[model samples]
Target chain A: MEKSDEALMLQLQTGDLLSFDTLVKRWEKPLLNYCYRMVNDVALAEDLRQEVFLRIYRSTKTYRPTAQFSTWMYRIATNLCLDILAKQRRRKETPIDAYLESESDGFDERLIDPSGAPDAVVLKKEIKDRVRSALARLPENQRVVVTLRHYNDMKFHEIAEILECPISTVKSRMAAGLERLSKMLSEQE
Target chain B: MDCRFFREQIVSESYDQLDADAKKSLKAHLQTCRECEQFQVSLNETQQTLDQWEEVDSPIDIEALHDVIQPKPLSLPPQLPAWRWLAWGVAACLILTLSLSVLAWIGVDVKWADRGLTLRIGQESVPEITEQELVRLLQAERHATQVEIVKQLQGALDEFSKQLQVHLEERQKQADAQLVLIYQGLQSQRVQDLGFIRQELQHLAGATEAEFLETQRAFEFILASHVSEIQKNMK
Candidate 1:
């Protein structure tokens, strides 16, 4: 049976290096996806993912089993993502154009299935691009909530824990995020 | 009931987070209110659209992360020269002899025989050093020297490894930047190719339309001439 994340973490705390490796392998993709949606930049998202694991490894000695391992891990990732976003804000960097440019830069080709019909492929790519752009336009808090709840499939309460806010705040953010996304997607249509 | 509360409930219900009691309440509200029902439908549609943004595979692998995180093991330094060890041994012997000589001068009797050195101070005899004891002392000194050499080597190795890691990371960043530039160039070229194709298609379409019009005009004239010829024959 696969070890639970907390179990693995506990083992890691006891100096079992393999447990850390397993944890990294297990969480790498989810964390990468989360960071990618959070920042909307592939390379930056990758760097953030690496940093999250590095932080986790360094903090292994202090990691307690009191909370779910995923919660702690995501909290680290969320903070790192927020820090990067805050830095971008300080620099007055507008990422909307960058997001659009990346979409057109053949990066979306990874998301497209080549075996599909040409017309269907094109249509799918267009819709995906629109969704990504609409997502990027969301406010940061709402975006984080939506990405965590919707994309990561975390429970609303779990999201609250990760964000260190009340569950109501998380739910309201989710509602607002969905509302905005619906409006923006309609406008795009 | 205020629709705002039901709207939030609708969002929760869309995600299947609503309790059974809250779900029933939301359903009853949705049955009566068109706006809440429409809100749920829109939220669901938005979710379905968001699903198109599929998860991408992480470009980085675990090994790369491991390499960055795992501290490199300390390496043993190169072997010390035999001459250096000889010089150290000689210096140690000289210091020991000088200390014994000083002790002898301070009203102490020192005797050197085949067994080892013996000392007597005021008719009280000190323990003699046996061959085994002397050999053990020399071995201990050599071991300590070896440990110190190993420690110095480890420190140097650690420094080199750190510098190498920084250099590697810098190079990796440079390569990543170059790759991004190349990718952007390709994207722009693709866009330009698409624009050129679009312009060519428009030109071809215009020429096709002009030829079509010319053919239609000629056909009309030929039909008119045929009709006139027929009328004349009938007259």
Candidate 2:
């Protein structure tokens, strides 16, 4: 049995370090993963994650849990990401791995199983490459929406709450995102 | 009334955010229309590709988050000279005194709120270098801002690297290869540009004429490949 995020967050409000730790344990991976995708830079993503936690820590006393815990957390993360996006708007964008021919992000080729099984090795590498490329095609909003709905298993309404948009907008972003990917995949072959 | 309603419903069905009455009418029409039936397949395929991309698994790490929460020790070592400690104590007092004075000058009611959102004020109060940044931002057609949108792309790239691992895992969903490729390309550009920009922020901000020229050249590269370019050209 797990303590609900609401319960954990309430404990955090009292300056309970352990409770905050529990909340962190529950959210860290997903939060980190979300930040990573949202910012697309490892350092910045990590920085953003820390920033989010710092925010949560500060707001803990003020947190009212009016919405779902995940929703609130995401709201903070999204706002931070959006601000970063706004700032970045002033400069030129360079896609990661554009200059380097290496595989994207930080999973070097070693992620492939070295079992000496050629096909399996090739299969894993191919999967990695394809997944990387598929993610790249999505708009930031679409990418976040897809990740939230499909990966985190959030409902459209919940995603709406998280994104602070109308539920219809979340659905719209999701639909368009999916539509865009489906068209791209069709062309890839 | 007949075909147009059906067509609108067909597209709207993909979102399913439609109201129940609309859904019911749309479903009824979809059941009867051959053209709509075919259209549904395409829509479903598109929906499926997006869903699948989310399912694909990627390598991700979770514990790295622990390091983010622990507050660093801010205390000085015990062996510091008495004078140094006294100086530090005096400096801390003066800083606190000055900050409080400033807050009092601003008024406590507003000061507390401002404290929570000082960055917003900073942005508002600060001046942009000349009118160049604004001019560049305005001239962009939601497409041409890439040259001046360095920070945005850098943040995007940073996000890509952080999320790439998760992307591997979330990608377990079944998807069409071509759709994935284009999605990847767009995402890659976002990620790459972000990385490029992050590495060059201050450099771009105070860029020499030569550097600005270099940035403009990079924008040309993006202009060559942006999806919006295709959209604009087609129009």
Candidate 3:
């Protein structure tokens, strides 16, 4: 039987490095996706994911299984992302529209269909670009709630735990987010 | 019933989180309410639209990440502390003195005394030398040894100075990087704090405006009531 994450964590507390490796492997992709959605930059997401893992490794000695391992991991990731976003906001380095334009260009080049279906691929890319743009335009709080709920498929309570907010707040944010998303998506149409 | 409440219920319903009773109530309301029904449809459509944004596989290099996270052994040997090096130098001097003494004790005519070294190679060491000649010879040898020792010390000092300069430069670069990071962090924190304060001020302003309007309405009602009472007395 596979060891539970908590069991692996316990082993890690005992200095079993193999357990750490296992935890990393299990979590890296999901974390990568979460970070990618949060930052809206692939390179930045990768860097953040690596940072999250490094933090987890460094904090192994003090790690407690008081909560689910995933919750603690996500808390670390969410903080790192929020910190980066805050720094970016202060710098005002890349405006959202400019970032979207650059990203759309890359998407156009990278998402070409290998099956020789250019029209279908273009339509799909357009839809995806619209969705990504709308998601990016949301306020950070609403965006996080939406992303955690919709993309990560986390329960409202679980999201509440991760965000350190009340479940009602999470739901309200989700509702507000979806309402705005509905308007934005329709506007695009 | 306010449709606004039902809209929140719709959102919960869309996520399949509505309990049976709430779901039944929402269903009954949606049967008669076009706006709430349309909201539910729009939310569904939005979710469907988001589904088009597929998950891409992560391109992280696990091996590289593993290498980065793992504790690495020191590539270079650990540097010795200055005191250890000093102790080793003292031990080397003592060893050299002991060897010289052994040679002298074995009748090799090598004598090391009062920081001066003397050596005679063969057993035929019965040469008659004057005390002044001996003193002159010892002084010349001592002066040569002092010059050589001074040269070696100067070389070691030069090397040590260079290493210290390099180390200080590296430390300066690291400190500069840390300062930059600290400045950026502080600036970010300041921005966040200002934003929070601005939001609080706006909320306070909104509340104060509402309270002022309510007080004005109360005063107007009281004034109208007084005027009616005076009109009745005049009649």
* The candidate that achieves the highest DockQ relative to the unseen native structure: 1
- Full candidate order by lDDT, most accurate first: 1, 3, 2
The prediction achieving the highest lDDT against the true structure is 1
Candidate 3 CAPRI level: acceptable
Per-residue lDDT over A1-189 for candidate 2, one digit per residue giving the tens place of the 0 to 100 score: 888999988887777777777777677768766775566555576678778888988788788978898888888888898788667655655654451234343543435556659986765555444544665557778888877765566778888887778976876677566556656666764
Write down the lDDT that model 1 would get: 0.89
lDDT of each: 0.89, 0.68, 0.87
TM-score against truth, every candidate? 0.63, 0.51, 0.62
Report DockQ per prediction, comma-separated: 0.45, 0.08, 0.35
Model 1 docking grade: acceptable
Candidates sorted on DockQ, descending:
1, 3, 2
Between prediction 1 and prediction 2, the one with superior lDDT is: 1
Model 2 TM: 0.51
Instruction: Give the residue spans of candidate 1 off by over 4 A.
Output: B73-77, B80-235
Q: What C-alpha root-mean-square deviation, in Å, does candidate 2 show against the real structure?
A: 48.6
lDDT of 3 by residue, A17-119 (tens): 8898888878887898888778888778889999999998888889888998888888899999989989999999797667778877654465566785888
Model 1, TM vs. native: 0.63
Query: By DockQ, is 1 or 3 better?
Result: 1
The single-chain TM-score for chain B of candidate 1 is: 0.40
Candidate 3, B-chain TM: 0.46
Off by over 4 Å in 2: A96-117, A120-124, B1-26, B33-235
